[model samples]
Target: MDSTKCLPRLGGDSSFELGLECREIAKTIKTRKIKYFGHIKRHTSFLKDVLEGKIEGSRIRGRQRRQWVDDIAEWTGKGIRQCTVEAQDREKLRSVSCQPLEQGRLRE
Candidate 1:
């Protein structure tokens, strides 16, 4: 008997055996980022300033990279300013952060 032929019968998919659907690492990272954004916004820290402040220097001659806040805004479907306001409420932010990504958009 060929061992390869028995693989499917033994449940070759690890996710099925684990009793959980596999999730992309990108989704997990986005979720953590949203939570961390709320934490920083709620507390008084230098990191908060760095996140919200613009750098004072000459611009580099190349395509600009995406900002951290921009990622949060895109993921949440909200403006950066609005995100800052909403982040003040822990419960609201937690709910928003936990929303699952679907079809390139977040589920309410």
Candidate 2:
């Protein structure tokens, strides 16, 4: 039970022969966020308000920070308003969220 033996070795032909591939962390995170947006949209709760950046507060006056919705909008290549409409349909949202960014746009 050697610890070194349990870990996948780095930069070797064996690693390739084993068919190991590096996961795209950013893509994975973005996909999960998109899925969570769908989940929030399907529910009737304050979480929706929070997700939409409607919290009660004043910002420190420099520049506005990006909202959670903003990332989803960019990733999905659709306006926030349109995303809201599409997110209402769970099956469609699931399909859109899991697709690669290039093909994730809502069908016209």
Candidate 3:
């Protein structure tokens, strides 16, 4: 895919560079996932439990698996508990989720 179209052109030799489209897409997906999780009733949602790591079990020994919550935390610069609290308010969650993208800090 052509990343240039997704990125802004710089006028000169500046240090700033646009983030990858894949990162942007991942961010969007993470936002949507969190929003959906927020809408679910915490009492009966298995997915919510999984997202919050409420289920207790040992993982097989190897490289640790990546988690949705971890991705969201890394992207938003917020802890999972803070994210969960903010996600309770749909509008607030949306605004917070979009902040990194707006500031062009989506790079790893």
lDDT of 1 by residue, 9-63 (tens): 4455765655443345556777898999999999988998887778889989899
lDDT of candidates 1 onward, in order: 0.77, 0.74, 0.62
lDDT string for model 3 (1-108, tens) is 755556765754443334355666766776665556557523457765565554458778999876656656776777878877877787877787556433333334
Look at candidate 1 and give me any clashing residue pairs. Answer: none
Candidate 1 contains a number of clashing pairs equal to 0
Q: Candidate 1 or 2, higher TM-score?
A: 1
Which of the two, 1 or 2, has more lDDT? 1
Looking at candidate 1, the ten consecutive residues that score lowest on lDDT are 99-108
Question: Could you list the CA RMSD of all candidates, in the order they appear?
Answer: 5.9, 6.7, 7.5
Residue ranges of candidate 1 with Cα displaced over 4 Å: 1-24, 103-108
How does residue 65 of candidate 2 score in lDDT?
80
Q: Whole-model lDDT, candidate 3? A: 0.62
Cα-based TM-score, every candidate:
0.69, 0.65, 0.53
Question: Of the candidates numbered 2 and 3, which has the greater TM-score value?
Answer: 2
Off by over 4 Å in 3: 1-27, 41-44, 53-57, 101-108
